[model samples]
Target: MARFNGTMVALHSPRMNGRGKLMFSRAVLLCLFLVLSSLPVADADAEQQSSEKALREHYDLQEGKRLYGEYCRFCHGEQGKGHAFNVTPPPADLTSPAVQRKSDIELAQTIHEGERGTAMGSWKWALSKEEKQYVLLYIRWLAQSR
Candidate 1:
């Protein structure tokens, strides 16, 4: 990628004529397109691999709910609202679009890893991967319904 300009520039001298320059320009553009387009395919492939890994390692949705109830319900509330706690800056409203705006990885990390120096404990050690997915699913479901 770094050397792409050098490669294209090198093509200029040998292709000085109008048609040669046009062909060279097309080739350069094609090369750039191929390089750029290849990135998305690689990214897509990585996403698929990660998703497959998650599915193979953690696909049980119910278990996630159960774990959420045991670990999160007290803080997040039965309905996933911020009402469960009486402490400062009450738990987040899982049903809120604000909360829902966060990405899955963010939610998963917050749940699995837990917030530091607060009531949120690391469920990463306590719950299985499947349970985490269920919790996330329940959170998403609650958010949508709200």
Candidate 2:
């Protein structure tokens, strides 16, 4: 007899039948089969969810590029390869994987909140929360294109 959670699994094969517990053994096998057979549905659901998330993210990235052109191109250039700046670190060469490796949250924070004491001025006053997210998606798109 094996117990899992609060249920006991009693198995009785022919060898165990000599012990007069063959019925219990059969019951346990049936229970195990029922439990195992029901698990694949959850796995299918998880795969479906993963696919949906990828599709949504892809669409958001497309929207992000539009937002970036409107709000960021003046300083970052049309390609985001950096343009204006006297000696300031040129706006990021956003196409680089090194720059894109940052998570979406990190990118959004940097764009919306800005890195202080540097020429990277905050856009919090200029863009809304959703706009910042779109910018992040645009940066991601640029990096992937490279």
Tens digit of per-residue lDDT, candidate 2, span 1-146? 77888798654454664546756667778999999988988899999999999998878887787888777777777777776544376677777776778777887888877777666778989888987887887877776676
Clashing pairs in 2: 11-25, 12-25
Q: Which parts of model 2 are misplaced by more than 4 Å?
A: 1-59, 84-87
TM-scores of the models, in the given order?
A: 0.54, 0.54
The residue-by-residue lDDT of candidate 1 on 66-129, one tens digit each, is: 7778888998898899798897657788898888999998988988888776666688888777
After the best TM-score superposition of candidate 1, give how far the Cα of residue 40 lies from its true spot, in angstroms: 38
| RMSD (CA, Å), each prediction | 10.9, 7.4
